[model samples]
Target: MQVTIHEQLVDVVLFIGARRRAAEAKGRHEEVKLWRYVWLLDDFVRVTGQVYRFEDSLRRELSAERPSISTHLGDHEGTLAQPVMDLLLETLDETPEPEQKQHVRVLIALVNFLAETGQLDEADGFVVNRWDYAPVAIAHFSNPEEAQAWMKSVAEPPSPVRILIGDEYFQFWYMREDNTRGMYRDYPIEPDLEWLTARGIPPETPSFATRVEAEAWLKSHPAHPYTFVAIAGEHYFAVHHPWLKRHSLHHVASTLEAWEERKRLVELDTDQETEDPSEGAGE
Candidate 1:
């Protein structure tokens, strides 16, 4: 009987040699299976947020296949223990030329793993409410300068999600826990950006910065309501869109705006413009 393996994990297993060693070292002992994980820095930080769950998933998978065996996980939080980090350090530490080349060759496996897991093209993030439009947030930066300030302020955090206007336009700066930088989205701009900017929604009275303050204001207004809550950093901003019929009304509105703009452009390009006969050069 052949053992089942997930394509995403194949390259990782090959490089780390943890799984290989376990199978070879205890070929005779039917009591344990071992696995070595190779995490990219960003992945390490993101997964670390849910570390307990990730660790459990791996252990569970190993146990299910080799039911009679126990599994193990390593505590390698800092960069020193990670494979790529170790590889870098090894190159710095005077690892043998042959072994170093071997490790470099093994990196091709990482590419295969990334492709299999859909990381190459990134995951398809669709609307939570499929019937409605996609999620959109217009983060106000008070002054234009504040845009720079806010972006700079949210510079470092673990897996900080970012909002990009378009793919090539502006890569909104975001950081990991250690303040490492990364881009959140890579969507197309020019045309696609209309999906996020449709009818505008203003803050509910714009009284306070926090959610609690907005909730208090809502009690007296009786009409103003919050559309979305952004729990990004130290503060959770409650965006109150008084014009929205429902909380998600903007989702559909935003989508319609993009569709309309694209359609209008198509019509303008296809229609033939009437030429003025005598007004060419002497008009």
Candidate 2:
């Protein structure tokens, strides 16, 4: 027996539009403006349910004719707009079945868009007004507990530990503690010591059966932000140091090579200064 919010919105829209038409027929210019404002407010609520602020630049521009309506309706005494809004609130409180069903169709389309975009997490949170209108609708879920769990996961995700096997037939493992979880790609390429240095990973390391153990070890050393363990045949290398994890192994290798080249150039310059005693003596 309960009418939906969409039905109520449809009724309000039709009612306001009818009032506007009637005012137009009677040549009641002030009343026409009032009904037009009501129509705009009703449409805004039905669609977005956001507050209709008078000070909004776009809203102010759209409703620029309100001043003329206000002057004609003798709103200088402050008796016009508030009373109309109160009447609207009262009407919305007791929503009846809409004579026209267009608003219901609009509501359906909006709901479908929200659902398709995965934003329908809290349907009831969509309120009509800052005052007394009821929430638009309650989001229906088959398993509410499951839905809650999913929301929780979205809010705070578990950490991920990646195990990568390189082309040089070495196993490399790293753990990042954050929302990202699950294993990533298998990098079938060998990472040399220079690649490890560029990533700020230690040249030596220890082996762990699980990522949990590696995370614990990494966390224990706060000084070393990033740590990785690599196993090549019978040998294992464990290192604890700082590194940027988001870069690919190839990229890190190239970056480190460039850095090393710069360093060598600087060192060569320093060596040239030390070797040429005659240059400084003349100066």
Candidate 3:
């Protein structure tokens, strides 16, 4: 029942190739070009898997020879080959696992292909759904000290911590808190801003000004057993709690309101499950 990385790679390659073939059949030249690059990258990964320390040589080869190859192939638009080659090199530096690195390579190739073909929405979706390059977690801490300790442990960083509170996740390098940015999602039941306001958080507080500020806030609210989740980053860790779930932080928020809303939803679901069916039937 266990699927090997090679098998997964083959599946991805076949899926992309099938799409490319379909596009070719329909004369969808743009899509065909995109999928072709993805398919080629998959093949490249498989071929290069046997070679240890091939990345540098491969990068040099691409830099020296890809231009000529593209020119000879008449890829005037740079759509057919260059993007995938560039992405393969770029992703190589980001991941240590050879197989995961290949996955990233193909994912980025597909992203570039979709973007170039004007499928912006699809490209965005692919980034969110298909790409699993970053580490993710949902954490719970009993007290501010625990949260602070957890934060201190992960402070030696590179990538930003992406925290999702309600329907939005904010990205901030825990070391450089001034550069935080975020996006909102439209959930069926909106997060409770009033509850957050009561807790002294501004309704429009977009992000923490610094890691110090974030830690200070956590320290200040010692009694609240809050939910913390990391959506994307290289190093991720958290304190465990019974209520905390380890699922991907696919729907997250950085605000107290969002966390409260999620808690409320869980409570509501639990309450419904425990309700007496016989009493309801009489009503």
Candidate 4:
């Protein structure tokens, strides 16, 4: 009887569980951490329904069908184990590199693990709800007033959940362990230019030193938000519009850092715009 790919996956999960347990029992903390974090096997187990059904029959089948794979996992000697999938595929000589890549991608999709930022995307975030403690979905509101109203009402007492608001700016309500609730908002302060940079604008790049100047530039160069840098107080901000024709002073930072960081942050949300046209054009 040929073992199906899904069955092979199930066997791998079973083998990983046994290996993880053996590592824990023997005080092999690093190996256990590898199985939990690097391979993300617990998430795999959960998604595969193995969390609820770690059947002895399946373990026995895994051991019998792929003894080499099983030995690699079950080895109590702890001779630097490899990821279960990698070991299984290598031993079977069945899945080619491309197919293995697809399988790995499928595995990741099944687990739904948040990779780096721990957020689904730019517009969505995860927070623990008071009642269930599972990740609750949160998103940005269109405007500040609605966000403020929601913060006071839906995000406060009697609500079973907390919400995180804003993309460039963030505001959220949280309850302390002591049961006190409070709101936290991160608002940008005025940036001071004198202490930050005696460095004048980059020779020719257009600099908007005031809101009126910035607004006028936005009106004329409707599509060129990334071309101009805005200077307010001591900081420089990357001026942008989430939508075309709408202007915003993105996160403010001290001169040099402001120029670099704000530009990078906005780039995450947008593609690179054309090079600043006035480049080399001396102010």
- Once model 4 is optimally superposed onto the true structure by TM-score, how far is the C-alpha of residue 94 displaced, in angstroms? 19
lDDT of 4 by residue, 1-283 (tens): 8644445565555655765687899998866765554244333233222321323234433343333223323332222224433543442364456544334433332223222112222112111111211122234456667766755664233222323343233434334234444444433321323222345444454565686776677667653323335446423343333322344454334334644566577686565365666788996
Q: lDDT per residue, candidate 1, 35-94, as tens digits? A: 222333223323223222233344443333212211111232222223433443343245
RMSD per candidate (Å) reads 16.8, 24.3, 20.0, 20.0
The number of the candidate with the highest TM-score is 4
Note the clash tally of each candidate: 6, 10, 6, 6
The TM-score obtained by model 3 is: 0.23
Selected candidate, larger TM-score, 1 vs 3: 1
List the pairs of residues colliding in candidate 1.
31-69, 157-176, 157-177, 158-176, 158-177, 167-187
Q: List the residue pairs that clash in candidate 2.
A: 166-189, 167-188, 167-189, 202-239, 204-238, 204-239, 205-237, 205-238, 205-239, 206-238
- Flag regions of model 1 displaced more than 4 Å: 1-73, 76-145, 152-161, 164-170, 173-249, 259-283
Model 4: how far residue 19 lies from native, Å: 15
TM-score of each: 0.24, 0.23, 0.23, 0.27
Tens digits of per-residue lDDT for model 2, 1-283:
8554444556656767776787799998876775655454444333332211211222232233221112222322232334444444443344465433333233233333333333333222222222222111112223435434433454332211122222111121212223333332322222344555546654455556654454465455432212345323222233222221211122344434554675688799999888956766966
TM match of model 4 to true structure: 0.27
Candidate 3 local lDDT, residue 82: 50
